[model samples]
Target chain A: MSFDTELAEAQSAIGDGFDRLFAATPDLPLHRAMRHAVSGGKRLRGFLVVAGARLHGAEDALNPALAIEAIHAYSLVHDDLPAMDDDDVRRGQPTLHRAFDEATAILAGDALQTLGFELCLAPGCHPDAAVRADLAFSLARASGADGMVLGQALDIAAESAADPLDLDGITRLQAGKTGALIGWAAEAGPRLAGADIAPMRAYAQALGLAFQITDDLLDHEGDAGEMGKAVGKDAGAGKATFVSLLGADGARARASQLVDEACDALAPYGKEAASLIAAARFAISRRS
Target chain B: MSFDTELAEAQSAIGDGFDRLFAATPDLPLHRAMRHAVSGGKRLRGFLVVAGARLHGAEDALNPALAIEAIHAYSLVHDDLPAMDDDDVRRGQPTLHRAFDEATAILAGDALQTLGFELCLAPGCHPDAAVRADLAFSLARASGADGMVLGQALDIAAESAADPLDLDGITRLQAGKTGALIGWAAEAGPRLAGADIAPMRAYAQALGLAFQITDDLLDHEGDAGEMGKAVGKDAGAGKATFVSLLGADGARARASQLVDEACDALAPYGKEAASLIAAARFAISRRS
Candidate 1:
């Protein structure tokens, strides 16, 4: 399928999956919190998972894509909590806690985190229990203490530090918090699809770094309305950013170079990986 | 080994595991929340898991036992959130969010939940990847939406109902929320130990119900100081309880009956199941 067609189909699947997920939970406070946190965004991570899975020969099973996206969504919900980013709004709507209560928001995040794994292990996604287990292990590693949680901890610590952190420190921090999960998504699809994972892992790493660098640049230059969050909040907090360290032009160059590296890593898979390559480029170029 | 020796050993292991868990995330707010919520528990759930594994003829592995307890601890922390029970105290200390900020507590709970699975998948637990995967899958199923989350949703819905709930209603609610995970602990050991699960599952179910019945009875008859948070809170909220339907004496009777059933379920396992039998009895007899 063409990239546009594939993207269109994935979007439809996500919409349907989300509708069922919401229906399953109904209008409870935690359910509402989940809906609020998941309402908008490009679904880039979902697209990447789908694209990677297709490249690696996964069939029409959209469960893997949905599960990966759910984890991404859950992370954003917790990341925007009052104790983390403390944002009152997300994707142009009041954040989960703001819409409900802080406690509800917390539970919603917890539910979604677990739900992601549940979706993966739901009855018939894979015949081999080991695959489901691997998916669970990978997701936990990406989102837990050594990965996203560590990144969040570092982000909290960075917010209060007076000294300027070096580029490596900032990179390592973002790699854990943001990059780790994205990379996991990319790698997960291929693993489940029975593809050789070496190239996919490399591509995912570059794509993840490129995605974050672009996000940093967008925060520096993008419109708040377009981004669904205040653009200058990072600067306001006086935290380190790629754009801050490397300058806007330098950051853009770095992002583009990373995208090129990401694409290069997919060469072994040929045309099957075209959507993934387009996704890497899109990650760096998208307004949001 | 006697229950006391096993209990002491499990407690020491839990103490060390918790020390490492807290130290790993030393952000002051997060650490405080962990300390506040994680301390004061008797680690009964951890002991149950160890005993269950031992009953299945596997030597105690501290990592798996600690992982099970971590899930138990994380659930308590989230369950006490304002949107849920709205309690300010647990085990006589301020709840996680009460001791720290709401956001910190939320993140701490999230991290802890993920940490449980992470600990299970950590290096050196089981050499077989399939066994490790089974552990993750079982844990996720027990704790995720279809299990605990569904029960919690039901509890929230039940709280606002005009009519008093019956014994069945209360039992179903607790079975999912509290019983599912407790049941998971019992079966997890056998699953991990690669032993037959049929007997373990039966024992877990009976023990889980027995524990809830005793809890309801305690809420009616126990002291607030001995029970930790306010006693009779359930009655005050007009939520259903076994005691509400069966009366205090009846609830106690049911608990004893269930304890007998739990013990009977373990009959085929012989002396190997002694600690599990004792733990089931202790679940009903404990003050806290």
Candidate 2:
């Protein structure tokens, strides 16, 4: 099947899985707000988990796939709060805080993070308790202080710092903020199989960095109608981004280089890893 | 050892554990804020884990002990946010958002939550991967949508609710809010030992409910100067609490009866359970 078909399938599966999970709980505004936060997304992280599972011949990737998506969604919800990025729109709809209220949004986001860990640690994720523990441990590391949260804090600090983040600083920040979870997602299949993650690890690092650069490029120049959220905010805040530091052409060239790095890292698997390679190529080429 | 001495030791151990854990990482406002939030609590939930561990002859309860306290602290940090309870003081110190900023407080609370799950899943927590998974999984459930967060949402809803909650309504809400984690903490040792949780579960239920009633009583009549935070806020909001629904004398009577129930549940352990029984008694008699 084509990568697009695979991606679309994973998206639907993840959405269905989340629907089932939330529907099992009592109906409260907290649950409703949680549903709203995870309702719309590209599900690219979920796709990474799905694609990796297929590549490694690992069955029952559904739980981990849903887990990563929930983590991604929770990060977005918290990041968009008025106290954070203060975003009013997400996926072309009002942000969670705007759609419901700040307290609801905060609790929803909190519950979503726990929900991700819960799903990862679910017995269905892997029959071997060790594998389940590994997944949950890695997830907590990637999403918590040493990874995503650290990156977010650094990014926020940079916004008000006397000096803007230099290229190295932003790269480090983005590695934590975006690259960590992406790396974890891609390597999850090998983790489940108890196989070496070196190749996928290298592949994901390049792919994740490329993904962020492309995101910066889009935010720098993408149309608001197409992007479904605000654009030019980085520049507006005078925050240094790939586009700001490297210029549009420089950023584009770097992204292309990183995409090449990503695909080449997967050469050990040759064409067997076609979907993942396609994902890397697709990351830089998409407009929004 | 006396319950007071045992409680003091657990508090020191948890504080030391937190210090070591946070010290290994880079010092940032987020970590500082997390430390602040967990710093001054009475650590009643943690004491339950310790006392239960002693009763079941299980060592290495430190991780699970710290995990519950972290969860408790994170909830308080979020609850005291401007968008939530909007409290400015905690433990005689400024709340996290007040000491730092709102954004840091949110991220700190978020990271502390992940930190809790991470500790529970740590290899040192148990030799059995299944046990660690169980601990982490149960922690998530007790603290997430199904439990603590649900309670918080209900409490928030009740403030603006059309009518004050009846006794049944408040009981259900308090069960989710305050009762769940306390129950989980008391059951941690049996869970670690792979023993039946029925006895501890019964003790925890009564202890948790009695604990909340005393909290309501304290809020109704205690001095802010002594409590180190706002008192009378429950009545100030006109929200129904155990004290509001059961009157002062009635509430005190109920708390005493529940303490007896808590002690009675531990008859299976005989005098081996004295500290836990003392803890149940402590729940009502103490002020702060």
Candidate 3:
């Protein structure tokens, strides 16, 4: 099947899984806010998980995919709080704090984060308890101080810095802020199958950087309506981004090169990684 | 050893554990905030984990004990946010948000929550991977909705309710808000040993309720100087609490009965539970 078709299928399955999980929760306003926060996303991370799992022999990828999406959703909800990025809209919908009150938003984000760990640890996510623990541990590193949170903290601190981050600095920050989770999602298959992670890690590292560069490219030129949220936000804030450091044309060229590297890293899987290669190409080409 | 001495050892061990974990992180302002948030607490939850684990012959309880404390600390930092409880003081010191900025406070809480799961999944927490997964899963449920979060959400909603929560309603909320984590801590020993949870569950149920009643008693009548945070806030806000519902005398009587039941539940363990019995009594008798 085409990568687009596979991605859509993955998104549908993951959405259904989330629905099933959240349906049993009490209909309190906080719960409602949580449901709303997870309601919309491209589910690219979920697709990465499911597709990566398929590359291996894993059949039950729903739980890990769900866990990754929950983590992503919680990050977005917290990042959009008034104290953080303060964005009022996300994925074309009102942000959680705007839709619900700030306290509910904060608590919902906290609960959603716990839910991610719970889903990973819950039975059916993995047959071996060792794999489950590994998954949870990996996710914690990707999302915690040494990764995404550190990146965010740096980003916030950078805003008032006397010197703007250069290319290397921006790359490092984006690696943590955006690349870490993507890298984790891409390695899910190997982790679950108890296979060597080197090849998958290589593929993910390249793919993650490529994804962020393309994201910067899109933000530089994409229309706000098409992007679902405000575009050119980084440039407007005078923030250092790939496009700003490399120029739009140079950024595009770099993303293309990284995509090639990503595809090459998957050669160990031979022809079976075709869809993943397509995903790499699509990463740079998509509008959103 | 006396329960006080044992509790002190647990506190010191947990404190050192936290210090070691945070010491390696980059000393960014945000990291400093996180360290501060976990610095001071009675470490009551940690004591429960160690004491409970000791009862079941589980060694190396430090990791899970640290995990529980991290979860507890994160909840406190968020609960004291301006948008939440809006308190400026905690444990006789400035609250996290007051000590650091709001953004740092939010990020610190987020990272601390993630750190809890990481510590639980880390090796040395348990000998078996299955046990680790179980620990993570249980902590999630206790910390997430259907437990603490659910209770918090209900409490927020109750503030604007036309009718105040009755005695039963207040009991249910307190059980979720405060009792969930305590119950989980108390059950850690049985869970680690793969033993029956019924006895520990009963003990925790009684102990948790008794703890809350005493807390209510303290909130209603304790001095602000000793309590650290404001006292009589619940009554000032017209919120329903055990003391408000049962009155101080009745609440004390109920707490005394609960202590008895908690002790009785430990009869299965006989003299091995002496320190736990002392801890139970201390739960109701302590001034702060």
Instruction: Give fnat of each prediction, in order.
Output: 0.49, 0.68, 0.83
Candidate 3's C-alpha runs over 4 A off are: none
Superposed model 1: Cα runs more than 4 Å off: A20-40, A193-196, B17-40, B82-88, B98-100, B228-232
Give each prediction's DockQ, rounded to 2 decimals. Answer: 0.48, 0.82, 0.86
lDDT of 3 by residue, A77-98 (tens): 9999988889888899989999
TM-score preference between candidates 2 and 3, better one: 2
Q: By DockQ thresholds, what CAPRI class is model 2?
A: high
Better of 1 and 3 by TM-score: 3
The 10-residue segment with the lowest total lDDT in model 1 chain A = A24-33
Question: Which pairs of residues collide in model 2?
Answer: none
Rank all candidate structures by their TM-score, best first, as comma-separated numbers: 2, 3, 1
Q: Report clash pairs, candidate 1.
A: none
CA lDDT of B266 in candidate 1? 89
Q: Which stretches in model 2 have alpha-carbon errors above 4 Å?
A: none
TM value for model 2: 0.99
Q: Which candidate, 1 or 3, has the higher lDDT?
A: 3
